[model samples]
Target: MIGRYAKLNVYQEIFKSSDFYRVAGGAFLIPVALLIGLMSNTAVIASLSLKELVLIVSVLVNGFPIIMEAVKGVMAKEVNVDELVSIAIIACMLTGNYLEAAVVSAIMVAGALIEEAVSDSARQAIESLVEMTPDTATLLRNGREETVKVETIRKGDMLVVRSGEIIAVDGVIREGATSVDEASITGESIPVNRLEGDDVYAGTTCVDGFIKVEAVRVGEDSTFGKIVQMIQAAEESKTESARIVDEYAKWFTPVILASALLALLFTGDVTRAITVLIVGCPCSFLLAGPVTTVAAISRAATEGVLVKGGGYLENMAKASSLYFDKTGTLTRGEPGVVEILPEGGRSAEDLISMAAAVETGSAHPLATAILRKAGEMSSSIPEAREIVSETGRGVSGMVGEKRVEVVSSDAYGQKGLTTVEVRVDGDVWGCLCMEDEARPMATKAIRDLGAKGINDIRILSGDREPAVKRLADEVGISRWHAGCKPDEKLDLIDTCVGSGLIFVGDGVNDAPALKAADTGIAMGLRGSDVALETADIVLMNDGLEKLPFLVDLSRKMSRTIKINIALSFIINLIAVVLGFAGVLTPILGAITHNIGSILVVALAASLRYSKG
Candidate 1:
């Protein structure tokens, strides 16, 4: 009997491949043909029968995928929501409520498809990172260089890196010297001079030097590989909200099923009860929240906002307090020479020249900034010998038989600028003060945050108190703390744990603090490996100005989730009432319920197109 019904050959491809056609085609066409035969032969309420057939066909096609999913879940030692829906459909079918079964089944499939599509696209940022890495590297074997797959390159292999070339591995520079532009890595524009023994990272470009490095790590062991691993790990870590939603669904799905069944039993009308059960399928209700969240995440990625997942997206909206690291987060990390106080009636150039000589051959950012400034002053710098860098203090060296010290402001009791005191021959010769300037967008970002109701802003830094206070004043921030070591920052984070806290930072030093916050936002444009990996949210452009926009997006997504949840509940309520009133048959109820589920999912996904 089933073989005769299955003998349709012209539609074989449709049955085998088409998702929509296979489930609905048979049920729909069969009932419609019967109705037409009855009408042509003799009228016998054929129109009402056609309505029931339409309902059944809709439920079966939409609900089949759900049934299949449930079967897979059972086989895999898991509970499947789709399988439960399939069970409900089977019950409707056995009771001769074919219309209800078809509607319920079809709706379940549509909801699952919607959720799958949105979540798949949400992780596109990870794919973007994968595409940015180089696939091959140049390896030197027996002094003969050859291009090889990056994965095949082994440690201790000497790799040649040319000017304008991306560094292929993380290793110490074994030979050659050149200035490397690590803007892609550190977000700093100034090219860093790399001599032998200087560590170089993968993905950074060699701007002006031919260098060879003995690779200590290659392929998946490289720094870039670790970053990819971190990204994957972070994505796997679910936020609290997502967990809540999962728990809610574990109970919500079954509750919805029981309610639909109860409505049918109490009404004592087979058709109306079936309608209630079919309409009460919780597909739309289940999809409402996730769809909106997924859409928000996807849109944020395109705008350079890499939100980790749907759960974080929801939390960011509710962020009431924000704790920011002072140095790189709110201001330009570089400390440039802002003031050159010449003593003994000497010109600014003279002090700068004297200071630059002492500051040269130093690794500190302030030292580099002063040297660069002195070079621009057209002041000749004499060679300094026995150069010494004092830990947490300043640098000293012999400049033409004169002893000079360029100490930080706190070291010399200076209060305003990040001062660099210049002394010649153990006597105070002059002062060259450098200030950490606020970023061009810092003030605007702060103002926008305030306007968005994020009024609690605090600046914590390892810098001196004066510099910290000055920067906070410029940005209109009320709370400021300076001289905070890495541990101190973590302690502060621990205090703020119960309250929502967001730590914004970009350096490797900020790793601990980033990991301790409610949401760690890394300046993606120039974040270090530690920052990128530890931080939950990565701002791709590293534009602190985008903070306001991100907050706005989060709030909008939260609102969307609320709306979806509400709609799901409202639809279920209406379907239950109608079913018990005997206004809908089981088959019709399932079809209507499936339609509602599809509509809810569509509404949730519409968040993708929402304007920020």
Candidate 2:
């Protein structure tokens, strides 16, 4: 029953292709002509029979494009397999085998369309982003809601999204609460309850409740738009294996044509030569690399891993060493205040409130951690004024009458501790120790990477040596370098330059190393904009578990391409040998070629089932 359903789906693919209808309308006349010839023996032209006239029309509609491509290929000094099939169609016509000529042309055309449908299956996930995008959005303005085109929305525009509607832009909720089905964005099925101030992305459906969202990114700048663009770019990219196939194809087509010429000259059998031409298109071999690459990329996307291109997947499969950024990558990225110490008879709440007040409106991980602890430990956080922050150092502001400062500290060089001094006026009010724990799957992910052939696993960080070391040991990584500045990380990665080196990082500090590596993967959920833009691949779900999955995917893609090519070669070789032996007719040869291409395409499409 499963096999029957699968066969039905294949037939559906053939019928649904728009090319099918165009070719069918012309080719459908062949059977009608055959019926008329049997009934009346009618001649459309004085010198041509009805079957010949029908064949010409079918060739014009179904075979004309391929024949013109063959002509263009010759003019461009590019030899392609289309030339072989084109010559075969013309040969059948000259021999007055009109029925076989029309049949072969239609079959070849149908095969190409089927290949196209199968190849495009890779973009199905990305294409759904476009289809799910709502064209119009309800704009809330001056206490009234106006329905307008989503394209007209700009940054800062408030959008009122209700239950069952797809959010049209990436924005922050300003009012109310709702459960959003973020499956389109993150591939997580369970609808998540979103409160006021929570970030929402475009294409995520509002499951229930209502919210007024302030648009932050819209149109092409939206996350959905950027993802679509990335997937399209990935599909258009050609891998190294694909390039090799193209180079061989340039030489391979001529060899097949030479064999056909030899058969015609030696045996004086035009039918045998035509059969060889019909079977020698090499459609399966030509499509093997790209189909496998696209399928692998699409499969990876489903697991929330966005690969930038096929070349990256090819590069990743060969990676031997992996470099990691300690914070916000292998770690959960959410820093929490571990312990707070106060001086001058002050309570811990007072210090946390002062630090949180000054850190308010800051996006730094440390600042966020401070604010989060304040919300839990302190009753109320006083409003801060005149806040100023020094890059990579600390933040200072006027909290009430006293000047509060949260400056970087090296108090305890202990494992995973990040301390910041809380100063009241010029005197130290004490310090707050913070820690970012390793992700729940970090150890497992690292272990899996080793199995996948990532030999050298190293950690790079600006944190204290003890902190970096602890996290490294926890994740089973023995090689680690701490206190490395941005330029230092860049220099380290440069020294490790090789074909398969990968650097995983999450912030601006790691951007340089990411760009320097063979494949750079960014933690998309919490990654800085610089990191996201610089990295070649993004773990959209922000899970380290996907790392092993990604590595496995890349290797599998490499293997799948090889397997597909081998299958194509074996099938085509069998068909060509039969053609040379005069055992296959032109029609049978065309059918065999179509079957071979379809089999290869099916194998490539099966790559979508890759396990994460």
Candidate 3:
């Protein structure tokens, strides 16, 4: 009679608690308790046949291992996801709630399988990245290039490609010229014209002409290598919801134990105590947050957006202020000749020739722009030696023993110029002016943030103060920090933490700042080595406008989490009340309580597929 009552109470607890494992574990115990009670009752009333004995033995044989495992796991103090399910079985066995125990275990196993399937859905993202690079390309070998696996293309190898071929590595154009479509790497839609001496990135297609490139970076050192690293780093970051759930479970288990003990003391009923223990397993509640995050991450990967970890996702939702790195993040990192002014009794062509000759060896976008303008004039470049470049300060080279300098106006110690001076051996030759145009989407992203009540926007850059200020003015960002070093950028981010900053950057130097910000948005299309890995959100399409869309999505996800948590707490509260009042049977209570847990899980998982 005592055991039967105990079994009933156990079922009641399983029904009351939102923890799936504890409830399921208790449910599995029900059949064993039922069999024991039935056989004991039968033995006293009638003689059992040998065939009947065999049938009972078979049922016990099937159930014994499962029950034994559960008991062993609990005794060993191993609290895995399955551990609570085991304890639930034990509770059901003691209370004679056989059917409820089996049902509970079945539900738990099913839910676990579903969660596993959903989490594994991330395989597609990695596969998509792998498919981006071609399997093989022609390498210049034995005085003539032949087809070979892209992976086998070693450093310093020369590769020849036709007009329609993709560039296989980060290399300089050793021979020929072509218009390369770098839309895959820099998101530049207009096919960029390349020539002898121009650099090409791996995975970029040669849209027009033909070029033989000498490999500079190969294998894992290429841009593709950094992207793969970013994908892996993003996958490893943790989510805030999972952390909170852990803390909740830590306290929840103890509280449940206390409640069960109190109920046993007051009523002097072991069955009632077991019921409380079974009900408070804390499994489903623990699963609620991770399931939602995993689902959202899976959905994002399908859309070509890679969120690094759970923590990144959570931070993006709460981000307030946005710190934009002007290059790549706000403006196309490319610079074009916006204006040309003549000074010092010289023409625009003279200034262009001088600037281009000095910048021929430079890698800056502005330098390239100047060089192209000179090339358009068919101006011959002078052979230069002893080339040197400095941040803020521009490129300087010795052309035929004549010192030539092509520095930004700010670097020359002059204020913002609609025109830059060209100097030869410390005498002004002429001026060639240029400016970086803001990306078409930059204005819209800022406006959208304002409309969404995120009013604060700032720019932090290591570029010349004048250039930084000019770009900031163009973008309408009033709060700006120019001439900042890498460490200073990180400090600026830390200062903005009270406002919940979102840092957007694409260079390797921006990595520390990105990691320090509340949410780091990497412009993946142009982002450098460390920036991609340290960032939380990656704009794969290089669209700054996606910022608003992601912000809205994060807010919606946060709201969903709140709703699920509220529902879980309410259901648990109601079940507890019903159990204390003796208004619910162990079997009905367990079933009803589990239904609520399932509902919470379903709602949380829905976030993954939600268009919101």
Candidate 4:
């Protein structure tokens, strides 16, 4: 029976695929039929009986689905707007008001169909993400390549991706160099160059050259797959406003039924009671919050901001303070070696070569900087053995018959540059000074946040005080905390929770703080998995400019929601009062109720085009 019902639902959806056109056609014909029924006096073709038959047919065609929905709601023990509308239609029909019943049913169906169309457009944003995954891959096996299903490929399988082909799995480039367009996943419009050993993700396209990628994650475990999953989960999650509206509807439906009964008993007027039922349907109130949320979230997705859920969107709008991590959040996250000072007559080449050798196995931004410097100079760095890293301090390894260590200069109270001391055989040899430049839009983002009324913008960093302070000054942030461990950042987030804090970071150490904040935003392109998982929002392109835009967008969404709710309540109150006063007939009540629903839907749809 369940399977049969599912099949029936599928068929129903298929039949209603062109719902707008069908509903519009039906709505246009309904009033014409009613007018003919009232005005026609012809005996042969335009007879009164023929017009009455047309009205009855129109009412059944438009109102049958609504009646079925009400029945389903009752079976599930839920009193909803459908039941109220069904009652109103039945009352109109019993009172010999076929015109009123037909028009009311047509309007309600048309309104619902329009709302569904708009909501479906918003949902398509997430659906598009799911559709981006490639179905097939060119799998390399036994010295030859053969096309195979992406699902059949396993980890460590080498896949040959040609230029203009979508990458089939998340992997590392094992051969060839290419520029991959990762806009779908990272939201970065520019294609990034990928060489041997560079990571490539699924759903990205190879735009320039052919490359062989060794698959690391396939199917649903890939980064693209995870994003799709998150979006689906987000859509299913309800906001506080939606929950409140649902609770209100639960009690309000019964109250409307009772009020309708009271009107009939006290005034002995069937039309007034039916009007009361029609006006108290709560259609606008039910749609106001969720539709706005869907449109806002869909708009955010199009702009490369992925809000986890409507609840997070609401909290993000309420955030009064913003906290940013220094390394990768405010800065470009790619630091470069500014100066390599050697000691004991060591050449600059020797110093950098040794540093790069020890840093080869590390993925830290500073390590990447040293490795990048070595690559730029085309220097042959010696291999390091028995390498070990000390958390928040340094890395040590044995390089070519000598013990090498790169330690942070924080112990010496150094400021400004991020300096790392190189120790050879237990004596300090030299220090490599690196600088991570502030993001180009960092200042503008901060200023814009201030303009958005978020004055408590602060910086938190695990770097030295001088370096952090310098960056804070550069970015125009007035408050900063330097040399902060992960726990300290978490503490700061906890303290600021009362004021509602937004923490933005992109490192493993930032995960705890991200989870502690009211709303956590992660830089998606370069962020650690832990940080991304913990964050409430992900800036896919790793752009700081999007931060200010997101803040403004959240505020606009909040305002849109408020306006929609106010308009819905006001319309409902006025309609109900007029309904009780006998000023509204059943037909007028249905028109007013549907108008309120249409207005709320229009307001919610406006969020999709809002500038913010």
C-alpha root-mean-square deviation, each candidate: 7.6, 5.5, 9.3, 5.6
Give the top-scoring candidate (lDDT): 2
Pairwise TM-score winner, candidates 1 and 2: 2
Predicted candidate 1 versus true structure: per-residue lDDT over 9-125, tens digit per residue: 111222344553554464454456446545744433654455455555555455554566667767987544554456667777678656446545544444334344444444444
* The best candidate in terms of TM-score: 2
> How much lDDT does each candidate structure score?
0.68, 0.83, 0.64, 0.80
Tens-digit lDDT string for candidate 3 (1-612): 001111101212222445444334544444554565566434432455333343334324333434555556468884433343345456665565545455544444434334333333423344445556777888888897689988888888998988788777888998998898775555456788888998788877989887889998886788766555555554444466667766676666567667767866887765555455545555456556655565565556544455666566666677768888876777787767766766677777766776787787677778888887777778777777888887876778888878988766743234444456667899877666666668887887888887787777889887788887777777678888888888888887888774567888884557787778887878765644554556777776677877787777667566666676677667766665565555544444555555665676567656655452
Write model 2 residue lDDT over 512-606, tens digit each, in one string: 78888989999887743554578899887777888888888898889888887888888878888888889999999988998888888788888
C-alpha lDDT of residue 459 in model 4: 93
Evaluate residue 514 in candidate 3 and report its C-alpha lDDT on the 0 to 100 scale.
78
In model 4, which range of ten residues has the least summed lDDT?
Answer: 1-10
For residue 58, model 3's alpha carbon misses the true position, in angstroms, by: 11
Q: Rank candidates, lDDT, best first.
A: 2, 4, 1, 3
Between prediction 1 and prediction 2, the one with superior lDDT is 2
Q: What is the lDDT of residue 524 in candidate 2?
A: 80
What's model 3's overall lDDT?
0.64
Cα lDDT for residue 570, model 3? 71
- Give me candidate 2's TM-score against the actual structure: 0.85
Where in model 3 is the C-alpha error above 4 Å? Answer: 1-84, 94-97, 117-237, 257-279, 299-305, 340-367, 370-432, 485-491, 525-527, 579-594, 609-612
Superposed by TM-score, candidate 1 places the C-alpha of residue 443 at a distance from the truth, in angstroms, of: 2.6
